[model samples]
Target: MDYRVAPAVRIAGRCRVPGDKSISHRAVMLAALAQGESRFDGFLAGADTLATAAAFRAMGVAIDGPQDGSVRVQGVGLHGLQPPAGALDMGNAGTGMRLLAGLLAGQRFGVTLTGDESLSRRPMARVIGPLRQMGADLAAEEGDTPPLVLRPVAQLRGIDYALPMASAQVKSCLLLAGLYAQGQTCVTEPAPTRDHTERMLAAFGWPVTRQRGRVCITGGRGSLQATQFSIPGDISSAAFPLVAAVIAAQGEVLIEGVGVNPTRTGILDILRAMGADITLLNPRDAGAEPVADIRVRASRLRGIAVPPELVPLAIDEFPAIAVAAACAQGQTLITGAAELRVKESDRIAAIASGLGMLGITVETLPDGLRIEGGQFRGGTVDSHGDHRIAMAFSLAALRAPEPVRIRDCVNVGTSFPGYTVLMRGLGLEIEEA
Candidate 1:
């Protein structure tokens, strides 16, 4: 579907965004593998996380819906998963394929994992290589794209795997594969990615041991204890509202219960550097992952160069970050983000093309983007059916000279359902096109 967003005048209010998508996906997968009933509080009811839950249930796991915004997951343990009734479709969730590959690697029953065209195009070799090392029979096309057919290995033997890229999805997949490995399976990251999988594994009483720069997990655990988990608010989903508040003339917004994992808060750090009045309040440890209320206010933003070290923490936020950069005073150049090319859309080209259409100065590079902040002449832009790109332009529309028309906002439902309603509630003039 298409959405029409007008320039926002001002926004000054508090809103609680949805639960963390990363944690929500892990919660469903881990809970499905647990030995008893698993309870989740504050779980994201978004379409993506829901796809994860449904995918697990298709594998014969018992999962119940959002009865009061919480879900019940019945774990079947490491080796207890039943063969799925049919092909498992993950939709647009890259996390689903990455993490589920680990669990399926050691299963006694072979299964096939597939996704939508967007997901099918994403390179799965990052995950496939590691799992293959652990002796899982996973088959894909020549390009390492999905339609992954995983054959039963009875048991996956543990091995140390090093990632070429700093990807949490790859690490989590290996760690999940480690769950069924014969011995200690270790995955080391060159840079820290989101540690939701590690944190949640520890919460489940799994033998998750971490050392300097590396995490090792042993397979063949007797059984994982079932427990209640409170899913924190998603910082990624909260990003739109956060940026909206910062860009609007006089808006101050407080977002409650967002996951504040330092590895994933690059947006907050980048915004702060650009002179945003962002703060973390009520910070506390939830399931070993930090959760807090985010407070943000409008500010005169000045652009700054984004370092590569912070890339892993804020990878998902770059689309929104591009918006923030566009509203800043100077030039913003992002490098070493070649990873963006393989997202839901070719984000570098998509963002550059979209913003350029709005009369913003955008220089597209092979890896990253260079944007010079200036007046945005309101215009229509295509989202390329990417959720983050859609939301990014929506936030930018607040400052656009005229209404910004974004095509295919239906993808927004994948990660942030009710986005139109949410932004409107924040006083944005958004209409369905």
Candidate 2:
């Protein structure tokens, strides 16, 4: 599907974004392996998470409803995942395949994970190498693309593996495989990726621990307790509206109950660094995550050098941050993010090219992107089937001289459930074409 957004007045409203995609994926997967039913609310009903639920169901686990963003996962024990009758279609979810590769690698039964055209293009060697080191019988396409066939390991033994780069999916994939391995599984990284799996796993009553920089998982008879899980509001999804408020005309919008996990708040920090007027109010703790109301008012944003350390935290926000940079007063440099190349699209080039079509100056770098903040003339752009790119340009549309048309916006549903209605509620004119 295609989407078009026209220049509109400031977006103003109090809205609750969808559940966090990262946590929601883990909730369903972990719940599938638990001994009892895992009851969850605030589950993201996005297509990616739904793919996870379906894959589990195909493997003899039961995940029901979503009738109202509510889901119950009846988990089969550690060794209970049945062999899939056919290849597992993972859709555009890199999170699902990467993580599930580890989970299924150690299983006594064999399975294969496949996906859509786009997902079939992402590299999987990151998880493949590590799982192989830990005695997993896994093989992938020549370029690490999908068609990953994981057979029962000769011996799913534990091994200490250091990450070649920073990736939470790779780290979590190995950890999930550790569940069934003999001895201990250790994953040490030079830098920390999002710890949602670790945090959520601990909350689910699993004995996982971190010593120094290494997270060690001891494998044995494992069972998870039945628990109530509430997925936090997705910071990635909220970035669109948040940046819209930053650049939109005279608007003060409060996005309530946003998940403010430190690992996921890089965009918030980056915006504040650029001197954007954003306030985090009503701070409190719920669901083992810090939740707060995020208020943003149109501000005269100025570009600041985004530090490398913040890259991992705000990595997903880079596309939208590019939108903010396009409207800021100076040059913005984003570095230490070569990982963007492997997303649903080559985001580094995608952002640079698409935003350039809107008349924003973006200097493409090997591992990063540079955006000069200034006036933008509008035109159509390609989403490359990336949700963030499509949504980011919407904010640009609100500030442009012409409407911003986003092609291939069908993927937006994989993250945000109702893109059109949500933006329209904020008083912007967005329509599916």
Which candidate comes out best when scored by lDDT?
2
Clash total of candidate 2: 0
Which 10 successive residues of model 1 have the least lDDT summed?
221-230
User: What does each candidate score in C-alpha RMSD?
Assistant: 1.2, 1.2
Candidate 1 residue-wise lDDT, 1-433, digit = tens: 8888888789867787877888889988888888899998888777778888888778788888877568998788876778888889989988888888887888888899999988988898888887888899999977999999999876789998878888888899998888888999998888888998898888888978888769998888666778896888889989999999998888788998898988889999888988999999999977778889999998889877888888778889999989988989999888878888888999999999988998889898888999899877788889988999998998777888788898988888888877888888889899987
Which parts of model 2 have CA positions greater than 4 angstroms off? none
- Writing each residue's lDDT as its tens digit, candidate 2 over 41-85 gives 888999999999889989999888786878988878787889878
lDDT of 2 at 38: 82
| TM-scores for the candidates | 0.98, 0.98
Clashes of each: 4, 0
Model 2 residue 183 CA deviation (Å) reads 1.7
User: What 10-residue stretch in candidate 2 is worst by lDDT?
Assistant: 220-229
